[model samples]
Target: MGSVEIIFHGAAGTVTGSCFEVRANNKTVLIDCGMFQGTRSLEALNHEQLPFDPKAISAVILTHAHLDHSGRLPYLTAQGCHAQIWMTAPTADIIEPLLLDSAKLQAADAARRNRRPDRMALPPFIPLYTGDDVTSCIGQIKETCYGAWNELGNDDGFRLWDAQHIVGSASVELKLADQRILFSGDIGGGSAIQCADVPLGGYDQIICETTYGDRTREPVLISDRREQLAQYIEEALGKNGNVLIPAFAVERTQIVLEDLVALFESKRLKPFNVFVDSPLAERVTRTTQRHRLTGYDLFSVPNIRFTHDVEESKQINSMSGVIIIAGSGMCQGGRIRHHLLHNLPNARARVLLVGYQVAGTLGAVLRDGARNVRISGHDVPVRADVKIIDSYSVHADRPALMQWIKDRGPVSGSVFLVHGEQHALSVFAQDIRKAGLAPHVVVPMLGESWSVSANHAAKRICPAREDLQVRIAPRDWTASLAALKSGLADRLRALPSDAARERVLASMTRALEDAESIRTIT
Candidate 1:
């Protein structure tokens, strides 16, 4: 058995920006390189040099495509670290657009500040990464299937499972000799139709998210959220004040669009123009459509006027009462901030938030009913009514999280609670210990190491199968087709009807093992 060291560089106390490094002797694999997006004091942390030399890192694994989980890659690659990014196919498709768009915005801001009217009087805050950086980062993708054990770098291997948070999201299980660690990037309950079937697995150690770990949100009935949004929009439309929604360009934007379209379809709303004002969101919608070719969609809403250029977006804002969905979901930075400045001072307008608003964010302050918020170095009075639809949060609640853990059986190693606020982690830690685990709880601080004692380490070891881990299938009879089915569903889902007719038909044969009940972590 080998010893491994881990560091909790980000997402330790506050949420947003998740990064961790696992070191096994000289080899290290970093999981998730998300950039911090919040207050300048905190976001400045990303601008500081990486804690460890990026050059020493061997490979990187992505939990999902959320900016908090994968945002910092362009900076990492630009600085050093030329390793491949391992993730499921859906993750690969989404990351390209996200990274590229993020980089473009960063470059634009840098240019704008240089030419600002107050350039002589004000100091500049440069963007963390550039478009050139994203171009390089997107080329390093290596897609992996779920539920498969495979070697990584020189001395490590990991098994991926369906996390169901996002299209390609997975809970990663890493093996380094006798030690293994499981990372829960962000988990999704079966609440949304797009989430894949949750998979059950074994792990020696587990690191999970506590975004909704503190409270069991009473199951948010879909009807309630729809009504909340409809009521807000209906009122705003009646006043003819613009409704500015700061939406994440990924699943959040798509779901909101879906809800709006549903309202339109049901004749519950008027024929007002809806503008999706993020270029990235437009591409992400295409990615969503690509997934639909396989018959899976997380609320496919159609008919949006995608506005990319600044002038076009400005024009939409100038023309009163248009519903605008813009990016940088939490309102930290982006064109959404510009749109907010105009609509927020108007009593007829509304600012709608349908996602988690982190602390130190304009969205959070607004959600918490702040009368005024500072944006772009200016404090603006809040005249527009702000509405928060917390039910629409993509992160599963406490009950859902608990069910997912229960379904995974007795994970016999150290379980670390992460990707949540300190309060959330504290409460969940006690509950985890109650589940009868060996050294059940670990809340790792930045750069903490967990090494195994030779006396306590397990002796069982599997021989390495190098090339097959990356190939179509491993040359082993013990591995079942059912495991492969869940791992490569996207590939299978995209197979031609005639070409994969028999192979696809064979996958429908469920084994007795499939009868195992899924546990929810709510």
Candidate 2:
């Protein structure tokens, strides 16, 4: 029988595009099929040839419904990954609309670039799959609830625990043979406006994300932030300011709507006719209504005025003082761009940013207090008041995350960090050292794997690992592998007696005692 291996198919040194593969019992399973986002060179890596074939996968275990974690499923399934897709009920409901819209967005991007799918060098740019592909992908999904353990293949099993990032998000615990490897999907803040609790751990190899790992996102009293946002809108509305909020299509859109509704009801802000201007965002809100009957009860908020038609969306801008929440939070694309193009150059407008703005995005420029921003084809003056609130983000910041980790089960394994900026990861690495968790803070690179085994499962493989796939043909690899494989095999055979066998076994145990697995390549 063969041993298990966890391969980093995505979300390596750089964040986003989060795909990881676990191969055991000669069956392959994927965790989180997400897309990579960023600069052209970085994004191009998503389209680059994969080290492994897509069709060989047996199943996909989704962590959440966020586009970054679920976006690439359509493309992979289109390429013939005919395995059962497993996720929480809400995640399954969410994947459908999100992927269909992402496909539409890709097609839109291709059309604007005036290029055929065949001409784009971007990964999955080969038409970026179709709406049909998304439909096919959705049809294969099976739902599993949090806190349940399900067997996937052979004796391999996993427990999907609450991650609390969004509705239906989960952190996975995978059991391979006798070994336990925990893949901590994006951990969430304990106190998001919506959702609850992070995962507890008893992991041998903990693959954790650090999106906000550098420093704690200091506490911002929710009431204070909400009041600040309400006052910003009220002041802007008094001046006839068009409040343009670049909101995420998922939870953020609903939060803004509910928050605004409360403000209006409380007489904190005048009822100035708010507009939710993205069709994609509208669909997500509709889907979120289903969650109201379950664990996600935030969608039932009254007085949310969503505009589904383009004409109605355009009419929102015609009105002088209106609140517009649109998708593409970075103001990179989608309905948000159209709103920004029309309102950002005006003196009587305010932009409320309540999400992370990656570098180079229009939102980032505004956050940096830039004097002007280029929108569509013209340079627009940035006369609008730009406001940011951390209370709105769903993920836990560093301090909150540390609290969860502190309360989790014993840290008997190596802590392998994933999903954060390099500098931010470096800072967290230093912080963890101060927190006193050991077995080394391993900063894993893209495509690097470290072998982990439970204390009871640790054993010496006599044949040595051969026929292992190499991403690139390694020089001197054949000679080194041959020598090691031969030497290890010879050592096993040369143990001539029970006494010698005991000696070998004792040495092996001693070696494993101090020999924690840690491989970090930048």
User: Candidate 1, residues 1-522: lDDT per residue as tens digits?
Assistant: 665666776776557678888777567888899876555455656777887788888888998898888989988988889988899888999998888887777777777667767575767768888777888888888888886666775556876777767677887777765666778888887742222553355666677888888888777777778888888988898888888889998888887877777777788877678898888888898897786453224334354688878899889866876799998789877889999887888999998887888765678768877666556545577889988778777688887777767765467656677777667878887877776644556665443445542224322122222331222121122123322433354556677775685665565544333544332322
Candidate 2 — which residues are off by over 4 angstroms?
A: 1-3, 115-126, 191-200, 293-304, 455-522
Runs of candidate 1 with Cα error greater than 4 angstroms are 112-124, 153-155, 191-199, 293-303, 452-522
TM-score of each: 0.81, 0.79
Q: Give lDDT for model 1.
A: 0.73
Identify the candidate with maximal TM-score. Answer: 1
Best by lDDT: 1
Candidate 2 lDDT, tens digit per residue, 1-522? 335666665665556778888777767779988876643444545566666688898778999987779888888888888888999898888889898888887877657555544346754334467899999999889898776778876678777878878777888777775556677788776642322453455555567787888766667776677798888888888898888899889878877777776676678776677777778887887787778543333334443467777788878777888788888877766788888878887888999898877544567668888766555544566778888876788777788666656655355555666777677678877877798754556666666655544432322222212221121112133323333443464467787887887788788878766565432221
The lDDT per prediction is 0.73, 0.71
What are the candidates' C-alpha RMSDs? 20.5, 17.6
Residue 516 of model 2: what lDDT? 52
Evaluate model 1: give its TM-score: 0.81
TM-score (C-alpha) between model 2 and the true structure: 0.79
